[model samples]
Target: MMAKYGACLLCLSASVVGSAQAESLAISALGNLDLSYTQPQRVASYEGSPLPAQVEILPGNDYWISTPENIQQVHFLVGQGQRVSKGQAIVKLTGPEVFHYLAQVEAAASLYQLAKSRYERNKPLLANGSISAEKWREISQDYFTTHLEYEHMQHFMERVHSTDAATDSLVVAAPVDGIVKLNAISGPYMAGDQLFSMVPNNSIRVKVNVPTGQSHSLSAININQCHIAIESLSAIAEGAFVTAWSSAVPQECNLLLGQQMTVVPEYQKAVYLLPKNSVFSWEQDSQVFTLSDNQLNALTVDILGSTPEQYIVASDQDLSQLQVLSQSVAAVKGIMLGLGGE
Candidate 1:
């Protein structure tokens, strides 16, 4: 009787083990599993391109005005950040030398007048028989000589006067309508001092610096169609044109002058976007869980491209019949049951 009981207990234990295995399989089938669908998509990506270390917005043609005076007092017109127009005065310089040149000009003019009078008087005497031929010739030559000297003096005087006037009251005008970038105050400027810099309001360009290695990637895309974001200004601007670039990444985007910005270039082909979480890795290979017939199916996916937000995958088989999950599911055991049912 004890042996019979022992045998019966063994049979019951076996039955319980089998039932547990079946229950475990059923639970795995009922558990949630992540799923994703595949579709043929055109994906676009760019290689790492070198961009400018910094970007700036500078005047296309910077202006630097200086006082043309050896020693003079300088005065500023518009202060820094002041808006100026073309031909607007910026600064003035005055000195004693300015009046000195004016005096020379006046003296030269007076001498020229005297020489003209002498020439008129001698010409009539030379033509008439009043004076001896030799005397007449001498007077005429003297008058002509004096006249030439007077003319030379007059020219020299004019130049001196003009220069003096410029020095006495130097009016530095804006070459174009722009904002003053620099301020020149409290200065006795020499002939070549930069008193102010004017940046044109309309002359603005979008600049992007691509890395030497990544320059080829930029070439593959349309630069003119690229989008740009000005971080400081919080403004969005489109690419006007690509002015210049070099193999080396410049410290600053000189064309933009010095504005720092984020640039997104337009790609040649459309990109296929998938959720970032949908991708998985197996043996260092990228894949996605595809669902078919209420079951999860494993598929090795070729990652064509990727971005910060999504990934682009490529597959040889049609994935229209499959369902892809955008989010992660709790358990993947149900996927196995779904596969068995299919």
Candidate 2:
């Protein structure tokens, strides 16, 4: 009887051990358990710190002055930071070709004057029958040719005279009366090349570098639609519609030409932003692991919007109940059992 009882006890013990082993194996198959992670309700909470930038303003109507002749080796009209005006002479140029044209005009004028005198004298002779009609006609033709030549010479001289040599000497004038910003001196530049730039004062713009993903968000908003706060001046500037974007990833903004500025772009859309690292892809689908019943469950979400530092997840999940993993979770054994414990 004792032996039989011991055999039964041993059998029972073996069965218990096997059952426990089966249960443990089942739990291990589930992988790691999801822990409660702090998830912000709003997407803006996930946005990373704003990028640092210096304040910059917009540029007014400015232009670069170049040489008229379109030749090289011409002197600059003004030095850097020199004010100028419209139609004001900025640069002066003198060349051997200019003098050559002037001499040609003088010679042409003298010959034309002599021809005019002969034509005038023949006109009377032809009427009086002192000279034959053919001879008079020849003198008339000469007069016409000389007169044309003289007029051409006069026009040529006028062109030369229009060239400014002294005050407007080789200097470029501003198209508008504004500050002279840049004057490039001591360079071999071709004619029509930019020699200087001008900009009006106090034209500030808030330039921001927006990621490609966030480009659509910007489109919904109008230019100068909102006011921007300048941290340095503690002042607010009204936004204005400037120019459209140029590049996919706009690294620079022209708040001030050649200057850097910090800007915060306000989006019209309600975006659920999050840290870029917090989001992961699984099976070609975007997902975030959230803790439910003390176990991690892959939550598929639609990406409503995103920036470099954050992701905006669109989902129907009860956000109040869902908790995402802030940090990468470690592999935990028997995770399935823990989830199924309840």
Candidate 3:
């Protein structure tokens, strides 16, 4: 706080202060105002509040790559923040779980082979009525299903497979290009837990949560109308407003996953948007000088808040048809002094 403005004002009042104050008062009285017209315009609004948000990596068709089952002594080929290309090995896992599944698949494969041989041998026998036709059909179906299950298991090994005949370590590869982003865990991640997270190329979106009181404003947002600015990045992220709730909206943006950032998301409003200079605050109240019936009328207004470009005003009077002075500062003081403009 300053010691006092009185000393400065007194020193200047005789010459400079008198001239400036007179000029201000004259301008207020003459009512020469910078006037502009406005419509609802989807309730002219802008976003200002820098809210907390995180950078999320959205996948193209398949988003995430997780572990197959419980595995121990896992090693990640890619480190956090490292860019990985498609077909690159991402992680390797070793544990009894892998061997157990491998054994089951091998057993299934052997059974499939035996069933196939038996079907070949019995196909003619059944045709000749040497064996039951039902038995032949069952044998063929068994061979087909077992072969399918075994083939699927083989494909699985391409992801997490034994290093050698002993099945020491299973290697998993990246399916697409992405930057590495891991989930929370210490060591030996279990089945269904994320071993490594990859933020696929061009798959970043943000989830913005607005205050519950501003639910109405949130709903008015859309892909075409909404935009996002991440302050941390010093850049603007154009968004596709894909999902919305009463108090939140998910917008598509380009950013790294799990990155904490501050975002300003543009949205629509239902109140009056005024120039900041138009509204003046008094003791416990706010007022705007509007030209009504060719007369200057000071209208009381509720200021929801200020945005980057406009002040959101809620006025009981219809301001859509009214012209408010953008230079209302002097006019406000003049009105207080009973020197109201004509």
Clashes of each: 20, 22, 2
Name the best candidate (by lDDT).
3
Residues 1-342 of candidate 3 have per-residue lDDT tens digits of 101111112111111111112112333455555544344222655443444555554324334666667877777766777767877787777778867766777798898889889878988898789988788779889888888887866665655523544765667777667676655467667777877666665455555555544434542322333454322221233352222222222333334456666554444554676766776654445666665555555566766555445566665567877767675456455555674322
What local distance difference test score does each model get? Answer: 0.46, 0.45, 0.56
TM-score of every model versus the real structure: 0.43, 0.34, 0.54
lDDT by residue for model 2 over 1-342, one digit each (tens)?
A: 000011111110001111121112222344454433667455322221232343333434345443333334455456555544544554445554334444566687887888888887777877889999888878888888878977955642432314442333233345555446554567555545565555443333444544443433443111222334322221232242222222111223223344443333444343354455556554345656665554456556666445445555555665545566556433322343364521
TM-score of model 1 vs. true structure: 0.43
Off by over 4 Å in 2: 1-39, 43-64, 67-172, 177-211, 218-298, 301-334, 337-342
**Per-residue lDDT of 224 in model 1:** 29
Q: Give the least accurate 10-residue stretch of model 3, judged by summed lDDT.
A: 1-10
Measured by TM-score, the strongest candidate is: 3
lDDT comparing candidate 2 with the true structure: 0.45
- Rank order by lDDT, top first? 3, 1, 2
